[model samples]
Target: MCHHTQPVTGVPLNSCTSREKTSILQLLTLGMNSHTLPTCRVHHMEGRADPGRVPAAGGRPEEGDEADAEGDGPWPEAGDPRGEVGDFLSLDLGGTNFRVMLVKVGEGDAGQWSVKTKHQMYSIPEDAMTGTAEMLFDYISECISDFLDKHQMKHKKLPLGFTFSFPVRHEDIDKGILLNWTKGFKASGAEGNNIVGLLRDAIKRRGDFEMDVVAMVNDTVATMISCYYEDRQCEVGMIVGTGCNACYMEEMQNVELVEGDEGRMCVNTEWGAFGDSGELDEFLLEYDRMVDESSVNPGQQLYEKLIGGKYMGELVRLVLLKLVDENLLFHGEASEQLRTRGAFETRFVSQVESDSGDRKQIHNILSTLGLRPSVTDCDIVRRACESVSTRAAHMCSAGLAGVINRMRESRSEDVMRITVGVDGSVYKLHPSFKERFHTSVRRLTPNCEITFIESEEGSGRGAALVSAVACKKACMLGQ
Candidate 1:
């Protein structure tokens, strides 16, 4: 939405007017306006649950119903990881790799549940990425069976925690109704189905996959739960990679569906699907528009397309293409390979930004497309990459700021020291990402103390912890 036109000065990196540069920075630093963010969108609908609503298992609400705090149903009891002691099976359906891990959590040195894992990795095949839901879940089931067979633990009905990351409305902790697919997933028969049922059926089809799914979790929620297991102070868990989303420990009283006696629970606020045709739509830059139009889902996940890792590299390419058109780089020569779709990726940005001595990696990446860049072009690429990624980091911090402030306002008494456990490649490996995230968070909410720590195995280990909780809750409910 930033209305900066082409520079009349010429195609030099520094030739752009101050207004043009500021527009890009504003898009990266704060988004269109603070109101166009998830913070305002969520605040307006915090407690708007419809009293006439009946909780349905794997239910889908009306169009605006997602805004209702409890319309998605009561937040399930997430079992305490602190006192959990046992060997639990965990399955992580990540974007790139599907993982099945046996996490051994038992009493350790400080009389706490220590986690150790017997891990197995299965590289999800290309066909499964865009294939049918059956193909995807069946493959995952096969991997589970393979892991059990390799470990010589078969025919055992072990507790399983399934971490399926997507938007889902869960009636209970162990089930989720798929809202829609993201992260370039276009598998048929995926949306509007229960992922737990799909995987369970897949497991049933595979006789060796005998474990019961005790809990179903989102990757981001698992990260928060994973961190909370280690440190009780961790109230938020997040994933900032191909896409960005956050989950936080919310007081149950505020959840309209829950009775006053129920304790606190974790809420998966699918904030990645944030932004719309209001101020946010009006604020879209030309590159952002291109990213969305070229994406699998157009006019959706506006925030994600602008800031998520999957689109960051594409953003760089879009900008580079613009420069090329303006005769800025490659002596105004446009490489046909650069115009090809999906040529540049987030990895290229990482390589360019992390370059210290020479931009060899950047050059090599571009070389694949048969283009040799000069020093000036390389510098321009690095700076643009940095700017795009910096914006992602800052936008992530802003969303977290909204979450922290919302929780703090409800409590209002203690100096709420919330800890956030973040996972994903962008936050974990990108240069200056950690510092940028921390700084932006501090800038937003200086009064409150927040610790943003990197967490791995959130989907794997966190699911195991949730399995422990689900089992305990099931037993208690029975009595």
Candidate 2:
């Protein structure tokens, strides 16, 4: 229910100005103010579609029920069905390193439980990374077999959770169709295939260990569940690494894809795919266009390309190239390394931005990249890196603000106090990114008090926890 009009700036319609150069940030802030983002619109319409429907889950109080006068459900109500006591296996396979974990959950006093975990990490070879699906999964199965042997649990059939950090169209808790590969992954026969089925087939081929794969979840969902163990208030999971995505608990009534309108379900907002519909064309500059055109998956995951670590370096490189062309850097002479694609790595962005008010650090990085930079050149490059990184942090915050506000409104809370579980190298390793991201999110969500908990080994633990929950639910249903 909003309208748009082209502004008359006393110049040609297509003419660019400083205001236009700064409008992307302004547009982000304004869109968040009006809750007009694509994410916000979808969340608001879906979450508030039914204001009076009673949740089928017994925890929520029904309207006009005298016993529920408090207006809030008991936090982690007695005998909560989510608690599961068992030993579970978790496999995390999103990045170049794959992990296998054995988690043991045991009952304790006063509804608390003790969790013990053992995990091993394996590096994925280049051949295995870009090979056929069978090859990729066979390597995974072999790793699991080796882990089970080390743990002396090769004969025990344990429930397993697969944490696949990619875009997936899930049909059930255990079945997901791989939409596409991201993070430089180009494994053949994976796209448009059931990810779990491929894993099961690979395990059968190995025949060294038996596993009951119960559920499959994205890394964000796993992080949320894992953090929920430490603080029950955690309902959102986000990753800002090679790619970006988030998942949060949503009222079941609002999820059209799922049948039951009861309690809540975690909805994975594959937000990296947000701008694929051309929603961000106005914000994209020539640098962004060039990066997109040369990417493995051109014109796809547009939002992620702008914010993810994989493309941030290339964006900076393009900007530096333009600066060279304008005679503003390196005396209008571009180094061969500067002209190379991906030569300016993403880590250089962090290193340059970490400079302590002196040009020494920036000069070192530029020189290492084959650039003979003067003091002015070093300063210019540092500013360019800061600009790119700042915009990325703000844009990510805008997306999260939309989610937090929607959650608060869905429950009719005057002030919602919530915790978000976060993971990934970009969010964790960048010196200023965490602070910048937190400040922006707080500014955007005025009605919410948010706490961000950085997760430790959360992906694997979360996958195991999700499997445990699914197993407990199945037991209750006698399935």
Candidate 3:
């Protein structure tokens, strides 16, 4: 029972009711398999073309071929060739951060390949998120021009890769229709518009220099590509931070959205939005429901609400709020700041968990929130933090396990090793997150050997690699 005891107080995890604990376990178990995922189906492209449009014979996606699925969308496989010499540029206009990167890919010791990159991050203003698409793109373009000037690459006509980490309906490698926006971005008139075209137009408006938009990809896909560049066994890519999503190599035949040769393509499993049908609804506690109800997009990203970093602190806050009402926390006098939504952040939880069992950090956190916590109160807070963080770790493992299990259905036992390329602050900085996640995966899939590789700047590096892929394919088609 010590394993279940609080690290500071050595008391069993009795803070929550037995029923609540059972529900949390069920949530973790349900995600350990994919059959329960609401969005697990042949991905639909909404108004996109038929999957059978690609001829069964050999040909790239021409003007009429269904473009969103696979044919010529820079579909990189395990051993795709990446040239060793190029100074490529990449722009990432996804999530809250807009970035521009320049890469010099060349040879290293003993003819081995090496890559060096420089990138700058720009924060988007609040107005841009709620304003028109043109406003957002214009700001992004200005940043790119500034980055180029800093690197003295003002005269280069470099082939560029665009990483737009949003739901897009691909028309080709360099073009795609923005299907929808997520992660608190609501760029008006951006939805249903082509992001690549928007970027191209934005760049042209600048009228500075020539830059070709060679490919467009999400961060998850780029992470996988980056990993595959370093290791041949990486097939899955994931981003687990403020929000969570995954992409993996899947058979073209199994994907209802694409049709063509007998090959595999990366499928962006937007697992963050997996609980649309309320599959995991029953397991949600009052605190979880409160966070959902108060969210910017309620009743969406259900899986993320339970597992993502942004919500972890809020969940802990809500539970503590409940305990306060019941005279069990903060000595029955909760601070007004603690009552406010979004006041607590994930860093606080991490700090509490990493404290040396002396409760100093938790004491400081509560003091900041206008609460004075007794020794017992600190222990209670620690327990709550551990419960929420542990559940999040288990959920992440379960999601990864589900992906592995689905892949195994069609793979041979000879395929013994699988590598996943993942990035995000939560995985890198959170105390004990990776250990718990690895443990959970091993416990659930005892027979499979899975490795997690950290691919930093996956979006930037991947965009460079994918641009190379697109350029090579274009050359092949011209032959």
Candidate 4:
């Protein structure tokens, strides 16, 4: 619904004219090499900044302090800490879709289980995302009810694992205090609400189901758990889908949370806030600045905007709009539909760049937008995709590099063999995203051994695992 247009040439708006000229010169010199794009180098902008140092908190506790006060020992590891067989449910709540699944875990060779029911992906309405907490939870509860009924999972008091994919402050595994909304979700009353309580209330009201909401995990943490459950070598979990973020295991000794438990399981480090150091030499273009300035958590997640799927298409649009104003491409006529959200999805752009089918894909994209296109438009579209994606990939790599550097500084280990479990459409489906990220990581750490693994273990199943762990822990405490 956005109808904003780029200013025509010769119209000066604030410092945009100077910024645009600077960006153009930089782009001309860099050509197709996006690694050379100028980034904002301002140091210590405004926000809840990351200290860049490992926090004192170790692995999160099993329950709230009340559980600890009950003299309950640490939560039991999923299954036999050493063994690998258990049953869990995972619910992945993403920016655009909600996925739910039930999984059974077993040990090596015999350590296999069925998805029981196929995973369900329900598209979330935009209003639901930005509406009241009640409306949003009501919609989610309805979807969960339908899913349970369809799968015939109606009788059991199932322990549920909830993967709330947003930044949160957690006192333990069973709770997540919302920090702020991101990924375009501006729902009121949800920012500071307890996500677990909201979902539990919704589920209970919607289905009259007495389900125990056990663990509340982040998507990256769920990815780590899923990967570690499968392969012990998997140390890092990264999400490059709608938004970019990562989680990795940390030693208990390095975390301040565990004042006494220094010999415990690893803690999840929210690595998204790592690369905020103010030592940049590049320039942030006007559009990049605008996107950063207007984001829900502006000045934070700067790198995320550069790489995440949600912003890639917008970046391309801004660049294309600029090009149009300059008469470099798409000149003369402007496509009215191009200004809306998702007018040009990154996937479509990538297809336009890589498709070999007589430019059919480009034609289809243009047709969908009510924009007639000629053969010349194909080249323009392809170039735009390439330019935008390349920038995104480079930015992603830089973020990864920052993590690697931080890990090296903390652990000082020799090129630790780390496997990054990745989930999301951008990282999994996009043709150029993975390669570009890999290239950037290699540039930063030539000798560091790293592997990118796809996680079929989604949030829904992850949630189940968390539920199982929490239940097991609670039982030990006789709660």
Candidate 5:
């Protein structure tokens, strides 16, 4: 447990007292274990309760258990193809949309798989995210049914891979216990229910599909797996769109909680919940607090609120509102456009900041907001972008640093090539996001080699691979 508080001082735009800055930096150095800090208190929101405090190391198998290494059961030996070539269906449930794809794995190179048909992306309604599981799954089932009908897919019992993009506790490749909802989902039945079983039942009700659900995977984990299949050096998968999270391979021994197994492959760290310690740089400002306090999971993922696209625009709004209230900038505007949540998307700000043609970009941005830009407003917009982007980069680096530290501690290696597969609109499209992330990594790990691989293969393909592996493992065990 670590606790540190600093006085807010200086102009809202620049400079923190040296002493206060030092204290905050010290607080961050305590690492993720600083959860017990007295300042860390869970905030209350209607319809949102604590997700039953997760253990410090997450609830997965601990490091000490031999089972932590090679999984709870036996490791499948080499030379076995693991049913690499098979027809499998995959589903990718994302924050804003859901996709389902049918893929056929070809026997040849390890990770070279081809999609049999075009994938489908359906824009999910906002209500579905917060409604009952039946409602959500029914909608998904209809999509799947429509896909199958359009493609004339065989009615046989083909295996299915379910890639659920949320925080879930898994006992194996096939089972996932829902931890809590992220990506704007607050469905009642989905919170604690078995997602695979729910989807399976939903599909079964249609009577036209007889798919066997085999594996469940988080989006980041799937990205990692997919990347690893293509490039063995890939070790990390990160998502930075509506929300931010990273998954990286961890040695089984350092986990401390697993009971058995020794040669485990990797443990997905799910590092989004990191940096919730409130030890962030003073730029976190009161708007950040309101965002955190009002979120479904308050007092958690403070750093995410600073960086993730889901909150960046809102942060800008808060800061802009403050500026207006203080008559500092953007004064005498309608302010009505900023009243709604997510009124300003992160991309809008990024566009303004990336604009290099004199003040034309700034003028365009303000014009879109129905506000004529003054020189001060232009400066304010540029400053806001820089502050938000810098804070995001710094916090993102902290997460990478934690993972690198964990890896070094577990392996005791001098220098290792770490490949991080990143996905999401913000990461892919946001200018300077990559540069800032690289800067952060370099600052944190001077000796390590890091590679960033952008992957188009999302949870859909990754889940299919997991399903194939699971089925192959099951068949081998039966033999």
Candidate 6:
């Protein structure tokens, strides 16, 4: 029984119902796996660093090489060929809105470089979002052409980096096969296809410009690499916004999908799909199942459905509905607006949690939702928000703890130090999410000394940086 037990992972298990306690415990189990969590597929960075000393196929690096240096970091060091000095174009297509960015990298003294960038955001139409692959890519190409025309650089063959923020299996830095779509995307003829190839075909059809598609990366990988520019110690990158996922540098030996066991490679842990194999079924609550069934990708991205911003608000609304039915909130009544799908946005969760106990903010928000919330009703809503958000924070922390602990053990260190680059509205904008998340991560990863750095323009900057690194490596390898 969880009764009378001390709290773990910052969640007061003693105060939780039996089902809630089980859910938290299952998350801990998922995070504490000793081996690489099979729930996430391994997508390497194609071994971006140490390009010259490429390892033989399916073989380990020669002993005494830096690849064999156990305690050394995985990122490239200073004074190396970072990238060619020039402007690179990067496309970031993660959500309904995609960004087209022009990044200028200029060399400075002592191998350091200065980067300047300008970007434009274009919204994807509802038809395009749910259309065929060709339609979607063609729309994206049109956006790219417009951006290039605005910059008056359509003729210059610039290196391009594509940041497709979805789950993918990479055959190389430049080739990623779309495993499946998440975040409400349902473009046909995309799954199991090479996303880069589709974009290339679309660009070729456009015929208005030429580009050298250099590299493609997930948003998490981009965040990690982008933050690596400011902090070389940042080897892990995590995103906790509309969706939750993470990436980290892993020892080559553990990445069974890749060939060589030489240097470390970045692995995109599409951890949002963590519970799809029914590992989480035993702990899932009624509200969770409701959200999952209603989502576009039902029975998918199950872990993300619990913690991502896209679902947090829905979860809270369901809880509120439950409370109302139990006569514990709103006098056992629900407004018509509250009954509507998506009337309660995720932002409401943040706003409700931010209320300072005066209940003014809570009353205003509920009133807008057509609810006449009393003082007691406002208090109950606030408590419900805290419970949902806290669970989300704790669950996210457990996943990150698993990654950090795995890194520490792989390096054979008792106390491993690392820095993580994180980005997302939920993590950055929430009133108490960062603190709650940090506390649980520390409790779960006792052997790690961790530093968290919030990323700025992670997807845009990261896509460009990935291209830069790939370009530099290619030049060295004479490829």
Best by lDDT: 6
Candidate number with greatest TM-score: 1
lDDT to native, each model = 0.69, 0.73, 0.70, 0.61, 0.63, 0.75
Clashes of each: 4, 0, 0, 15, 17, 0
lDDT of 3 by residue, 251-306 (tens): 56655554564656676666676565665665577888898888767887777787
> Tens-digit lDDT track for model 4 on 1-479?
01113322222222234554454444433243565532221111111112224342112322332123211112223332223245555678867888777666454555544333356778889888888888888888887777778878767667777888877778667778787677777778887878988888788777655567777878876776566556666766778888877665444445455454333334344434434443331445676777677666676656667677888777777666666676444544558887664577776756776667466677677668766655545445566677777777776666566555555545677676667777888888877778877877777765478877788755555556556555665676784
TM-score against truth, every candidate: 0.83, 0.80, 0.82, 0.81, 0.80, 0.82
Sequence-dependent TM-score of model 2:
0.80
For residue 237, what is the lDDT in candidate 1?
81
Residue 101: error of model 6 in Å?
Answer: 2.1
224: Cα error in model 3, Å: 0.8
Write down the lDDT that model 1 would get. 0.69
User: What's every prediction's RMSD, in angstroms?
Assistant: 6.5, 9.6, 6.4, 7.4, 8.8, 8.3
**Which has the higher TM-score value, candidate number 1 or candidate number 5?**
1
Scored by lDDT, model 2 comes in at 0.73
Please provide, for model 5 over 1-479, each residue's C-alpha lDDT reduced to its tens digit, 9 standing for 90 to 100. Answer: 11112221112322434553353333323222222221122121100111123345342421111122343221224313345577888888867778888877665466644444358888888777778888888889988888887778856677888878777777666777787776567878887778888888887787777788877777877776666666767767778877777765555444444533355544555556554553454435577788887787887766567678878777777766655664455543545676666777787868866877365676677667777656445656666665666566666666666666555545677886677888877777778777877776666666688888887766677777766776776776789
Candidate 1, residues 215-292, lDDT tens digits: the string is: 888888778767765676777788988787777656556655555534455666666666633335655788888889
Displacement of residue 155 (Cα, Å) in model 3 is 2.9
Superposition TM-score, candidate 6 onto the true structure: 0.82
Give the runs in model 3 whose Cα sits over 4 Å from its true position. 1-81, 412-415, 476-479
Question: Tens digits of per-residue lDDT for model 6 on 209-234?
Answer: 99999888888877887887788788
